[model samples]
Target chain A: MKNILFFTGRELTVEEMQEPIPDLHHFAVQPGVSDEPKCQRCGNETNFSSHPCARCGKECLYCRNCIKMGKISSCTTLYRWTGPEPDVPKAAGILHWSGTLSPGQKTASDNVLQAIQQQKEHTVWAVAGAGKTEVLFAGIATALSEGRRVCIAAPRSDVVRELAPRLQNVFPNTPPAALYGGSPDRHTYSPLVISTTHQLFRYTAAFDVMIVDEVDAFPYTFDHSLQYAVQKARKTESALIYLTATPEPSWREDIQSGKRDATLIPARYHRQPLPVPSMKWCGNWKKSIVPPAVLEWVKTKEKALLFYPHIETMEKALATLKAIDSRIESVHAADPLRKEKVAAMRRGEVPVLLTTTILERGVTFPGVDVAVVGAEDRVFTESALVQIAGRAGRSADCPTGEILFFHYGKTTAMVQSIEQINEMNKLGRQKGLLDT
Target chain B: MNRCLLCENGTEVDSWRAFFGAKAPPLCEVCTASFNRLSGPCCHVCSRSLEEDGECTDCQSWRKSIFHSNVSLFHYNEAMQDVIAQFKYRGDYVLASIFAEKIRTEAKKAACDLICPVPLAPSRLAERRFNQSEALIVCAGLTAAPLLGRHESEKQSKKSRAERMNAVQTFYPTGEATGKSVLVIDDIYTTGATMRLVADALADAGAASVKSITIARSGS
Candidate 1:
């Protein structure tokens, strides 16, 4: 027999499966669920096909909605164990981190624990570089000590990769398994799992605690299936914790309606303000390479990043800028040499580096000034602009850096990003977290 | 769990028996509907949709080699091209599984004792980490016997038809064959040159007969 492809908590087989019904308690679930090929797992209806199914040798309807995750059809049967539970080990020292949380982090961490205990929803409205991951460590440790299963899901693979090792380091006793598309840790039966949201489709009511980091990031916020995947992966009465640098407006409404209790961490871990962006109207930045203001800004800065909306324009600008300085290089979404370019920029060998929104989030270049060539472009949303600005002032050694937004005209996103940064600054100062 | 591989959307779609039966589709209705099937009058040898009538001149040379008839499921259109590219190049294993049931269904007609998929060169295998045809076989609920191996050579995609046909004879039968019907599998039936070479080698190795099945057929 082939080894069962057990992901999260769901058992899947490429072939038809049927186990003899053991004499046990069979509780009634949603009635009329298996009828009409409805996929109760994702709450989607079944799709009919005119072509004969190669497997069943009949014209059948299957759930195309969740098919990316092995298909769930009308005939697909799912079983769960409702037998007596075995005693779980209340493991001590699951978390062995030596670092201590700051006063703000401690407060937020306490709220996260409270939310997990109550099995309620909570959001950490932390700004960029606020040590959001650290805030969840206390809650995660508490859940693990109670013998509860926990999952930390992110939308992007890079974030999942970065987080898994950190989590495993903190929870040394329990080796946390990471799940991505081609993840080799698929078969590891661990209580703690760090996976991308897409991998959550294979799970069904498995996690007692589900923490989704970067909830507002791309693919997660925009993709409904991912949101549904998270819901399906968690137990009915489980705590749903969302950690994000920028929480959408719906989260605020949920908090207002008492659907959620949120802990807002506006200040960075270093207690410094996010660099506010200054806008300049440089007409048609596509034709202009190294504009006067941008040139002046680059000259004074030890290292800087020039963000363009399109790769074509960036290549043109990079070609023109190379004449001024041979150290200038550009990286885009598909640039094969992106890693080397970024590394060069970080080492200050590349005085000016051009990039796209691909480097908007989760990248930190200490004290490097940022300049956006096309701030008015739709590619630079309010969230992206704030994250680009966030790349500045990330290091405590240089907690203040310049961020310039050069565009043909100021778009609402640019204005909003600056406004959002200022608003967070005001909130940070009001809470006495920021130095005067 | 993921955005549709073909269309990057996450819209809800209905479940089909195929959706739930075995290997599920990683695509949406709109994307799946665009699968340009091999419909119209087909060439007997290559299974390509012939513009006029019966087997074209390409298969006339088959009498000299251990060539036989071939069947392809879909026409190599732009949409199918993208799907195959993602499966072969990008290493989307899920996409490869989506065709398993179809290939298995096709392989059933052959009723061969042993199934074999065209092998990748050592250099290509090191880079791709998989042979796409073998993955399809895995999805079809069968293990293909490792029968053939290839020498380090230029990729079929990079070479023209003439270049591919006249290119070095890379494939050689690696296993013994005695009175067993053999069906060769591959992702695409491009020039028939590689398949002909494999067929000739298989025949020389004492196979009863040789035939081929492919997921897509290039336009003649």
Candidate 2:
């Protein structure tokens, strides 16, 4: 029973003094030194502390509108207001940012930002861990500052949860609300909302800007209804941006043929070369135990996420691994405590985590590695395999990593994934985005 | 041109709308109403609007149909057929929402416990990357459980009616909805064969009752 605290924002306590912690009466905002703090809602500057709001308060500094609407309970101060409203960066005044754009993030961010500003549509194709989220931070801030409702929708709840903190960090002054399964703040009204794509059905023309992450991820990629939801949720003149690591063949053709404007971010943030996962054929891979080379590699690595094609195989593999070393554990979709298992891996509590494709994207672990069993299996399509490989080599602290593919035979998909990685590397190098 | 299902020939029309010209052969408001009207009668079991009797002979015998009830929006003619074809073959996923809105108007009177879509076997699903029927249900503001008929079988297109009827018993339900009524959905109702098999399977799985909701019913 260890504390499971996650980093939602740059530890605000360290960065800003007197960051207001939420309270029942009023949220803690940066209370200025005038011996009196003004209520942003009521416009009352004095005699509002520990007493009912003078103008219309049921509770101390609570607004009449908030009290009438009964939404007063859930309104937590999203950010610590640091200075006068105009002193803080507004939408247009924020400084233009142009740095060494990691090849993968460059064109995608620029094209998407332009599309949003011009009220057009654009698609972004990049490999996983290509820093897709980080690239859009500036553009998202721009949209929010302009008073546009912005939304970033992912296909998976786990991904939505993973992205919330990263966004919270970059936009510390503008706390972004994360919406997903069972989240307390899911219904919280925020100008910017990060949610699972399925949640888009609840809105219509609700956002002036929409960025759909993992456009090619299941079940959104495969589910047409959800795709329609993404389109239906946007305003008439709103910009729609699609971001995907593995754009399907049709989308690729659309980009190349100039029917759709697309930009590619072909490199990861760390700039360390993506590991080339070699296909190791162990004939009758299912029946055979972990190959000697692969086993030895796993033993040598301090920690790893061993991906099996199926849960049954993973259970068998886990039992076998535990027999060798009791520290090994397996995880799959049906496991109720999958989060706990993943957290254990993050905390270095588990040496190896055997799982299905559920951990393929979004989750990142520093100093950890990956190896796939039955890599040529039906589940290991090019996209799935590529995403699994991308899980490695994400953390800047441990950029160089390994991906071992244990297969019965070299399927076309297995070769294609490796080729795609190599192709991206070539593109990255050509763009001079590769690490020297 | 395809024998003009709505209007037999131009001589039969008194007046024609400009949209329906020579090749299309106007339905001549009168003939159009006669065909479009569902007020006359319908099958007691299937609820398919019939031209005469309240119950079509198809529902009189269980031997003729395994489906407990079947309901369709229209007699699959050129227009309805084209719309459905566009949705399936053309990747017009948006049509699902449009179709759903129409079905909602028609579904306001009738009721069922749950709306379940015909499950596409895993292989077909992988190839198409989606279940068209499921998409339609989603558009209709309905949730589709999609859990039925685990095993794969020969494509319904390749089998004869009797073969299809024989194959129907294996539709097998997972009993996810044991006591609740089910409103099964499909793109089209042809010969009522597939719907019958699904209904029988649902009953076997202990569904209180089963009814069908289809976009088009083929006019054989």
Candidate 3:
């Protein structure tokens, strides 16, 4: 068993906390990374960082930031990484290649490879355009070489469509089965099966290597039953790999504590830094056909996506935009021709496509700008906003673009999402892993 | 001396309950043979063993079941019926486990590829906070396949045999079973209505064959 540290007020080594289940955790910090920034109390700057606090000898240190926000009273906690890093076998045959893997991708792939070799569970979190699909090929190839059945499960049907061809090319000799609500070749069986997570429920201790992509996305992430189903489908000896861009705080804690093995990919695949979405307050935005500045921006943006929270507002927004310039079309879940309309936008037949969160994932274009009219809407959580912003600059043709979240009042999720994107970018830049 | 349940002539060996409680007096050999004959002739289709005929008259003919066979352990006597009701309503999970263990031994003969419990409608699951069939599966130490019963229909308790058969076709298995042999499990088998219908559902979902096992079989 791997050793991991857990903190509760006092710094205790992983060996100390032998309790079966712990209570509400304060913080899960990496072990031995005690580069304390500054002390809020006494305004004292401490450079001498050690396992134990210098003054109080307490391992938990409350930073100046939290103190300034009057949140320092809460106990500070640290979590140490515990999982083993195993080496994975190499990929066989001409592996399908459609994307690039930055240093972060290498880290993720390496972690996954190790997990597979050791028969341990691991998580790989890469920002959108981090080439999540490409990074997985090596690890999957490793598992396949060991005569293990690999399953790549996603939450969305569209994602399955996008990965089908790429996976088919990667495992060229061994035909992979694509399973979803509607797939003509679903009947054909293969060792490597790509299916929606819901489809996993039908299986019993089937896959030896189950890779759940977009683990933090809809359906799979939100539905408890679906999560249970994935676990049930996994054989007792199998390693479950969770891949996602935006992981919830608890999962991050689990990783920090070494309770779970996690590899973070903070950079995009193309080596270009992710575009940061600037916040704009369009005051009484509904009254105007288009704000002068926004209108000018739209005219210049050859390909752009407009997001509306509600269907009724989307209809009005589409009508208003069309009255000013007749090149706008709106699509929602209820739209009969949603697939066709999305296809049209992808082909550049329509310049601006207004949509809901339904288009938050799956569909991708080379270069398209995105704007959310109501950033603070109920549907747009921190996770949703990050995914929406991720859609802005994803393609090889147009890897760098802009994302705008226009709102009357901003929520914590909106602010947090921007911070997370910037934080990932900063981490990438610091490591010199940002796409050139 | 306690009498045997199957044959009143033999002395009762201490039951598992009495043995576990350290109250066992020694089993009578005659009682063992009598209890072994506890089983009776059941309906070929529903497992409701008949008295005169080998198979019950109701299910003598070939029926439409992807599940070609069915089996049950105990006859639905007052004690068994009471135990089932208590297992579900009184949260006596141990009883369900006991029932499942009995069913598992009986089902092992079939060698089914997968175990599918008769799905509880979402509405019933919400009300009870658990699936009765799921409890038995766990008790049986069987792998419970992920199959959902959608669109709530009339309860089986109120429906007649024909109505239950008609309603079974509507219970669709969400995913394809890929022609695997499936064994459906439930706590009790009444008119064999639920089993026949569940078999049909499995067949519709591309199951190659279906078989059923229940904790207890209802006597006519």
Best model number under TM-score: 1
lDDT tens string, model 1, A172-239? 88778898888888656577889999887767788889999888898888777678889989999999
Q: Candidate 1's residue-wise lDDT over B100-141, tens digit each? A: 778888888878878887888876864554678787887678
- Angstrom error at residue A346, model 3: 1.5
Taking all chains together, the TM-score of candidate 1 against the true structure is 0.69
Report the C-alpha lDDT of model 3 over B1-220, residue by residue, as the tens digit: 6432222244543477766775322224543322222365545666665665466656755365575766777666766665666555533344454445467777788888888877767766544435677767865777788654756877777777666645545477776788699888787777676777777777777888988877776746
Please report, in order, the local distance difference test score of every candidate based on alpha carbons: 0.76, 0.67, 0.68
CAPRI-style docking class of model 1 based on DockQ: incorrect
lDDT of 2 by residue, A1-436 (tens): 0000111111111122232333323222432212244433222343221222212223333222112111111121322222212222364223244445565676677777888898888888877777777678667867877867778999988788788887776666556668765677643556667888766654555677899999888888776656766776677889888889888878888988999888888888777777778777666757766666557766876789989888887787777788777877888887988888888888998888889999887788886688888888899999898889998888888887788898877888999999999998888888877775
lDDT of 2 by residue, B1-220 (tens): 2222233334243237533663333234434444332334777666566776576765665574335677777777766665576555433444465456657765554587777788777776543335678777877887777547646877886778677655645577775777877888778876676777787777776777777778777644
Model 2: docking quality category: incorrect
Q: Which stretches of candidate 1 lie above 4 Å from their native place?
A: A1-8, A15-37, A40-50, A63-88, A253-259, A289-292, A299-301, A336-344, A347-349, B1-5, B8-82, B85-187, B190-220
Candidate 3 chain A worst ten-residue window by lDDT: A1-10
Native contacts kept, each candidate: 0.00, 0.00, 0.00
Ranking the candidates on lDDT from highest down gives 1, 3, 2
Q: Give chain B TM-scores in order.
A: 0.88, 0.73, 0.76
- Judging by lDDT, tell me the better candidate of 1 and 3: 1
